[model samples]
Target: MSTTGLYQDQHLEINLPQAMVSVDEQRLILTRKEFELLAMLSANEGEILPRNVLLDRIWGYSEEIRTRTLDVHIRRLRKKLGLYGDSYIQTIFGVGYRFQRFREPRALISYQSPLFAATA
Candidate 1:
């Protein structure tokens, strides 16, 4: 199995495993650390992973690394995600962040095709 996560849309796609991020009409590029941070957060979507946890998981630092580093990285990630970033990822006060599983409202579906149908 692959250890990559993908955040995509009609115009853009981010490949976490390849450490490549592509925006619409733009080139895909990212550093290793940036990709790692994004992958870790994305892997634990909807969980407000604390700063220490993120540092430990991504940087392998045990509560000793500067917290600002994490903050900086998160800010960068948010910028990279663009408009959809706010919808997918959220910051919890005094804690950390949560990657929300993008849930498209059923009402928005105009067709009843099987591909769009939900199965339990």
Candidate 2:
């Protein structure tokens, strides 16, 4: 149960058990949704997590509900992730969001397979 995820050249770390995200060793104050979004994206780094998948996973399943909440949360997460945010979480344009690979940290590289793993 290794829990620390180091990304962005090791400037960012996501501690799963703590549900804590830190940038350059400074803890960020994220809403629960923000933290969950960050955790989900980080856990599945280097892949495009579809909008529907994110909505269901974060907000729980709800009859394909339409809302701008996901975008809002992503914006907040990016802002908190600081300068290299967009480089980390990328927009795939008309599809979904992809968590770009900052670097292959040893602890969690196993999940960084091809982007379409979930769909394929």
Candidate 3:
């Protein structure tokens, strides 16, 4: 459970009640299933959630059932997340998926000649 139904990190923010998601401060339009998937993964953070578990939690599917719903959703989510998708969502392979915490981009150091000369 997140505070005030909100899950937030350095690069992502999710409002559960509003069913809204934003990345790097930019809002993203997502489907209902997509939002739920992202919410669950992000909430768990670094914990790896197996396919069965995710299926059950998200779609009420049994472990024995074979389907590509999860995979499809994951792919869609990744594509929607852009560059941050792969960086944040990780595949366990033969297991499940996990949402990695977002990390702030490193600040770039300027090495302009004028600035360097002025400092010198």
Candidate 4:
């Protein structure tokens, strides 16, 4: 049996057995909910986790129920994480949230339609 469930990426590390999180080698003191929330998001990585799904998973809330609990927690988490949280955890407007390793630099890439491909 493995007591340690490690979730890590380029900048973050989560140790489930110890309920510990470290970002860029700095440890963060987090509440139980905050830790859980971060763990969930980190586990999913780049995937967009729906609000309903997060509520259900973290708080056992039904999809029919409406609340701002998730938002509040996210805000706190972002504050605690500082610039890292702001850059990683993203709001999908009316949809939900996602945790990405780093902000994508899509603006640097120019888009070319198929019709213009031959000319360029």
Candidate 5:
């Protein structure tokens, strides 16, 4: 599994048969819930998955839980990603989150008038 990043490329060499995730430098020891969450997000990268969806997938909850359990798990996953976490995981306001392979490109167009310009 190859994951492209901004500064450096990140990949998870997983043995699907054995259900193991290994990085180049260190092994990311994940809890059962963490592993499930990571797998789900990785499976659908760049897609904005809602909180309810996550809860249903990971927790298998029929009814919504009034707690920050999903948030906590996400935080842990972010921590596991270390320094490069910020660039990969993005927060969508009033919506959900998305696991990105790379940072989104910034717009080049400028709305404001130029402060200095050559006079004709």
Candidate 6:
């Protein structure tokens, strides 16, 4: 089994000590908040972390505090990671987000963006 980041079978790797993340062996640059966010999600792979929990953990803010920072961070992270498939983080809609797990190494086809529908 290939253990890259927080979980096995994942192509991405997060070196917390180095504060770095690599996708498909390519290094990625992220802001401080972005790195923290990725680390949290990677640490809790397969588990859905609520927006409130994420904010509290990463930003050290109470759940009652209102902010769209998490959303912005997530968007930026996704863009940097070039993530688009089920193997990456997933939105739970009105709830939270989950870092999905990979069962095996995937091919380019698996990275197909959901933004583009399959043309029959």
Candidate-wise lDDT, in order? 0.72, 0.78, 0.88, 0.84, 0.68, 0.78
Instruction: Determine which window of 10 residues in candidate 2 has minimal summed lDDT.
Output: 1-10
lDDT string for model 5 (19-88, tens) is 5665556677888888777777766677888888888878876554776888888898878877656666
The order of the candidates by TM-score, greatest first, is 3, 4, 2, 6, 5, 1
Off by over 4 Å in 3: 104-120
**lDDT of model number 2:** 0.78
Number of the top-ranking candidate, with lDDT as the measure: 3
The prediction achieving the highest TM-score against the true structure is 3
Query: What stretches of model 5 exceed 4 Å from their correct place?
Result: 1-17, 103-120
Error of 6 at 33 (Å): 0.5
Pick the winner on TM-score between candidates 2 and 5. 2
Q: What is the lDDT of candidate 1?
A: 0.72
TM-score of each: 0.65, 0.74, 0.79, 0.75, 0.69, 0.73
Candidate number that wins on TM-score, 1 or 5: 5
Candidate 1 lDDT over residue span 31-116, tens digit each? 67777877777777667899888888887888765658888888877777776667666888888888776565467656689987
Clash numbers, per candidate: 0, 0, 0, 0, 0, 0
Query: lDDT score of model 4?
Result: 0.84
Model 5 Cα RMSD, 1 decimal? 5.6
* lDDT, residue 39, model 5: 71
Return the clash pairs for model 2, or none.
Answer: none
